[model samples]
Target: MSSAHALMLQGAARSARLLEETQAQWRASGDDLLLFAYGSLIWRPDFEVEQALPARVQGYHRVLRMRSRVNRGSPEAPGLVLALVSGGSCRGLVYRVARHDAEAVLTALWAREMPTGVYDPKWLVCDTPHGPVRALGFTLSRRSANWCGALSDSELLHIFQHARGRYGTTLDYLLRTVDGLRAHGIRDRELERQARLAAAHGLCTPTI
Candidate 1:
């Protein structure tokens, strides 16, 4: 494996710690364990969930700003992924897991989302049709090494055209996210704009 890939595998301890702390917090609340899903998780949750609800979280919005060096790209040609950054509000889904199965479910979730420790998993207040719930969300800080900041249109186009990892190309990932959000009745104009731009540049078929 590449040194970068090896380093990514080194986050197991951190993932375990975060999972432990989150479980403790959930236990203290004495409620069903809630997890907020955005991007790929919205469409392809690999874990079992007792319930899923459309939810929105304030004080954070989704952005295609995190650098993906493994799943969607590589060390030599990193790709972009969605992350919840500060400000505005985000519409997504909240998944509830029974307390009896929370530990196994969260452990698998951390393995999927926390490898390399790029996201900060936190409990955020999510507003749903039923009511408000505190759900664990994976957020990215601007100060993180994986933050991509604001990239120019040309730069994004290049990544979309060239970056690919074990999972697939960057453009495919973007298209999937757009479709996933649309399926859930959530429209992110910025994501739609990106899809349009990619199509115009012949990176992939038009999705918007």
Candidate 2:
């Protein structure tokens, strides 16, 4: 594997260790879980409860960072995919769930996000109203027809623009992300720029 990939694996390993250590806390919390969202989840929260205000964390960036050919709309129809961009910050939303209810919440989230198998679930640290919360989030699916390390702003914007999902319009996605990010006191230069563009141009993503 490439050094970057190896490093990611190592990071993921360390993250696993952290989770292993935190398992009890996770279980004791009535099955509470945190979710880190960058795309549609920024808006829908996948029918999960809005437990707290959104927040941000360093070390992970958002992009068209993955592939999807199975669950989402077909490429012939908007053809949206995920990108694996790094080295920048991402500003998005976060969700909190009671431990006992996590499975139901995440299952629904994964179903909606992985409709075309473009992403994988992961645990991410989130800045929460009460400090930090560990969230279960998803990255692009490893199994996909069109997934990549990078995508054009326009390309990603297209997915964002054509934001129709099981929930609401892509515009709702952009608006909620922008608003949530601002609410969290988190600011990503690129995301902010995009949000501005979305506002000026009437939302970068549109409902499918």
Candidate 3:
């Protein structure tokens, strides 16, 4: 066997293990499960949602600081994605899944968000319009290799202009997210600013 083929097999095996572990962990969490959507999940849950409401989670902020090497770009040229990082607060949507469907919903979520195991999924307290509740969310780990930290406006625009993957372009992801937030009367200045930068470069259409 060739060295390149062996490495490919190793990578596939690693991804399979990650998926299995994520499914097991989520299953053990409990029957009642809530998921917080702070990014693409807001617009595209792609899962069965029994109930969804506007919610705010403290001690975290939504920022485009993670690399999406598959959804929005390839391994050679990764695109950026949002993840909840420590500090501040974030307003988004909290979705409650039916107890019977918890396993399936979480399994799909893990498969979509944990392809690289870069996010740490946890249940956090969220203040919703109805009331406060505990919800599951994916947060970024500073220790993860995919963490992009902060980037300049120029860097952001460049990535938005060129990055594309199986899902779509990175710019499409950003614009759609801001649009989703707007529908909920949520204004994310940071994301809006990045969209404007991309629009100024003719990479993305202005949605704000």
Best by lDDT: 1
**Models ranked on TM-score:** 1, 3, 2
Clashing pairs in 3: none
State every prediction's TM-score relative to the real structure. 0.92, 0.57, 0.87
lDDT score for candidate 3 against the true structure: 0.83
Give per-model CA RMSD.
2.2, 8.1, 2.8
Question: Per-residue error at 4 for model 1, in Å?
Answer: 5.5
Show the colliding residue pairs in model 1: none
Per-residue CA lDDT of model 3 for 5-100, tens digit only, reads 675476456656766775666578766668899999988999888889999999999998898888898777789888999899999999988878
Among all candidates shown, the one with the greatest TM-score = 1
The residue ranges of model 3 lying beyond 4 angstroms of the native Cα positions read: 1-30
In model 1, the Cα lDDT at residue 160 comes to 93
- Predicted candidate 2 versus true structure: per-residue lDDT over 71-119, tens digit per residue: 3333343433333233444556666667667656655654455443334
The Cα error of candidate 1 at residue 11, in Å, is 4.0
